[model samples]
Target: MWFSVAIRVGLAVLVNQKRYQEWTHDKLKRFLENGIMPNLYYAIDFTLDEAVLDVILIQGVVQCPKTMELYTGPTYIPNNVREMTLPGSPSGRARPIMLITTVMRYHLPSDLDWFHQPLTHYDYRKQRATSLAVAHPS
Candidate 1:
C-alpha cells in the first residue's frame, strides 16, 4: 500500500494542529525565498486509537560520529528519520517508521490556495481521492 511507501521513504505526518501550523509557516517562508516548491502539508481528520507520540523532524544534513570513522562518502550523511512504532503492527513484522490513523478528507494548505482553488460548488457526498505519494517529509 501507499502507506507502506510513506513509512519507508522517511516522510512525516504532523497530527498536532498547533505544531503543524508553526512548522509549516517557517518552512513556507524559507521555500519562497529559495524559489523551491513548497512541501505539501495534508490536514487529516482521524480518531486517535492510542497514545500520541513526540515526533520531530529536523532540517538540513545530519552527521553521524560513528559513520565518520568508517569509509563513507562526504555527501553520504544521514537524512532519513524513522521515529515511533505503529500501534497495532504484528510482533515479527518490520515495524513501520511512523504511525498513521485512518484518514478522512485529505485537505490542502490554505497558504497555497492561490495556486489552485478547490471547487466549493460541488457536492460534498462525491468521492474524491488524493495521493499520499506526493507528500513531502520536510
Candidate 2:
C-alpha cells in the first residue's frame, strides 16, 4: 500500500546519516497537526553508472487560503546536468553534475477578486532569516 511505502521511505530517511531526518520529521508532523498540506517537492541527484543518489525535499505552497478561487497548477519533474568548477582548481577543470528535480506550484485563479500577486523572492529569504533568528536569537 502507498501508506506502507511512505512509512518505509520515511524510516529509511530517518536512518540515513546524511539526511536531515529530524527536520523532515518535524515539518511533516507540523503539517499534519496544522491541517495545512503545503506543496512538497523532491530533488534527486544520481549517477546511473555509479548508482549513487542524493535526495532533498522542498516544501512550498501557493497561498495561505485555498477557498479564495486559487488554482492548483500541474506539477513538474525535470532532470538536468550541471557543470561546476572545483573550488581550488588552478587548471579550470569543470565537473558534470546530475540534478533531478521536481517542483510543486500553485496558481491563483484569474477571476479572483482579491489582490493576486505572486510571492516575492525576498519573502522566502525573510522567512528563513526569521526562523534562524527565532531558533538562535541574539
Q: Judged by lDDT, which candidate is best?
A: 1
Q: Tens digits of per-residue lDDT for model 2 on 1-138?
A: 223333334334334433334556656433223221211212112121212122211111122122322112111111121211112232221221112111322232343211343433322222223333346667
Going through the candidates in the order shown, the clash numbers are 0, 0
- Listed per candidate, the RMSD to the true structure in angstroms reads 20.0, 20.7
Per-candidate TM-scores read 0.18, 0.19
List lDDT for all candidates, in order.
0.28, 0.26
List the candidate 2 regions with Cα displacement exceeding 4 Å.
Answer: 14-17, 24-138
Best by TM-score: 2
Cα error, residue 87 of model 2, in Å, equals 37
User: How many clashes in candidate 2?
Assistant: 0
Residue 69 local lDDT, model 2: 24
**In model 2, what lDDT does residue 115 have?**
32
Model 1: lDDT equals: 0.28
